[model samples]
Target: MIVTIDGPAGAGKSSAARSLANRLGFRFLDTGAMYRAVVFAALEQGVELTDADALEQVAAQLRIELGDQSVLVNDQDVTRAIRTQAITSATRYAADHPGIRALLVDQQRAAAAGHECVTEGRDQGSVVFPDAECKVFLTASERTRGERRYHDLIARGEQVTLEEVLEKQRERDERDTTRAVGALIQSSDAVVLNTDGMSPDEVVDRLYEIVQQRRVAK
Candidate 1:
């Protein structure tokens, strides 16, 4: 069985999916980290974010591995490194490239083949696993999402102003929605969940309930 959660950044898709997977005894796949891994590689290679050809080349040659809760890139443990602001900022560029999306989507599919997995990303429901047993599109008010991101960065000891974070969030939102390849969108069959006032536990509960219903129906 595959459960896919698709949403914009700061919507708690990652945390919710991880928790949901654990509760359901399924593997967890964080697809956003794959793009972040590419961004990290680009930075290391001095490849400009706007250089789609170069970025595609870098992605083709890059080796990214996702484990239980960690990520490895080029034989190095960069589980934490790829979450930096720099990689976050450049990830949109990498995700916008068709070549990179095709490659990474294949990797994601291969990783989840023959396993019960909860996968989350901007396009997981629409593109990566449209046939998933459960597909959820999570969303929240921009203000709430921005605040969540701001607090998360501060907690990580990153100096980020709320205003700056909000601005970046808006920029990312625009890019994600307008990007040509695998742009963030809610699949028609996906159950849309507004998470503005919901806790992670609440989200997981609702998702589990949905899963139970599906299982009973089957």
Candidate 2:
């Protein structure tokens, strides 16, 4: 069985999905990290983010591995490297390329071939795993999301102002929703959950209940 969680950044999708997967003893796939990996590879190769052909070439030959809780590229652990500001800024550009998206989607599908996995990303439900058994779309107000991101960055020792964080968040939201390939969108059959005021545990419990109910119905 596959459960897909789609949401914008800072909406608790990653935490919720990971927790849900652990609760059910299923593997977790963080698709966003795949895009980040592509950006990281492109940067290493001196490829411009907007150069679609070059970016696609880099993505096609890229070697990315997703472990239990870590990500590796070309046998090198890049769990922390890909989270840099440089890579984060370029990720949307790389992910928007249709050629790159095609290659990465195939790899993502292959990764989940036989296992029970919970995949989370902007396009997991709408594009990567449209036929997943359970599709959930988590959402929250922009202010709330920005606050979460601001705190997260502060925790990481990144000196960033709340205004700066909010500006970046807005830019990301626009890019994600307007991108040509696999644009961020809620699946038609998805269950939308507004998480503006919900705790992580509460969100996880609700999702767990929904999954169980779906399984029982099946």
Candidate 3:
């Protein structure tokens, strides 16, 4: 079974999905990290973010491996490198490219072909895994999401203010929702989870129950 957890930033999808995967003994696939890996590669290779052709080439040639918490880019461990502000900002460009998205989506599908997976990303339910047995759209209030992001970045020692984080979050939401390809949208059959006041474990438990119900219904 493939369980997709789609959501905007700071909705706790990553943490919840990891927990859900652990509980179910399913593999966890972080699609957003795949895009970030491309961005980090482009930055390291001095490729411009807006150069779609170059970005597509980089995506096609990338050898990315995603472990429990490690991201390897072409035999190099770039787990922490891709999460930097510079790479994070450039990831929007990589993720929005139609060619790059196609390549990565194909890879994501192949990765889950023979194993149960809990995938997390903006377009996991809407685009990458529309036929997934269990699809969940996780969301929270904008203020709450902003605060979560602010604290997370600070914990990572990123020099970002709450106001800046909120502004960037708004911009990302607009772009992600309005983008033409692989847009951030809740699938028609997806169950929406409002995680405004829920803990990560609570969210995971609820999702696990839902997944169990889906499995039985199937």
Assess each prediction's global lDDT (C-alpha) against the native.
Answer: 0.89, 0.88, 0.89
Winner on TM-score between 2 and 3 is: 3
In model 2, which runs have C-alpha deviations exceeding 4 angstroms?
A: none
Looking at candidate 3, the ten consecutive residues that score lowest on lDDT are 81-90
Residue-by-residue lDDT tens digits, candidate 3, 26-62: 9999888899999888888999888899889988999
Error of 2 at 168 (Å): 0.9
RMSD of 3: 1.0
**Ordered list by lDDT, greatest first:** 1, 3, 2
* Span of ten consecutive residues with least summed lDDT in model 2: 81-90
Per-residue error (Å), model 3, residue 53: 0.9
Best-performing candidate as measured by TM-score:
3
Q: Is candidate 2 or candidate 3 better by lDDT?
A: 3
Worst 10 residues of 1 by lDDT: 209-218
What are the runs in model 3 whose C-alpha is more than 4 Å off?
A: none
Candidate 1 wrong stretches, greater than 4 Å:
none
Residue 15 accuracy (lDDT) in model 1: 85
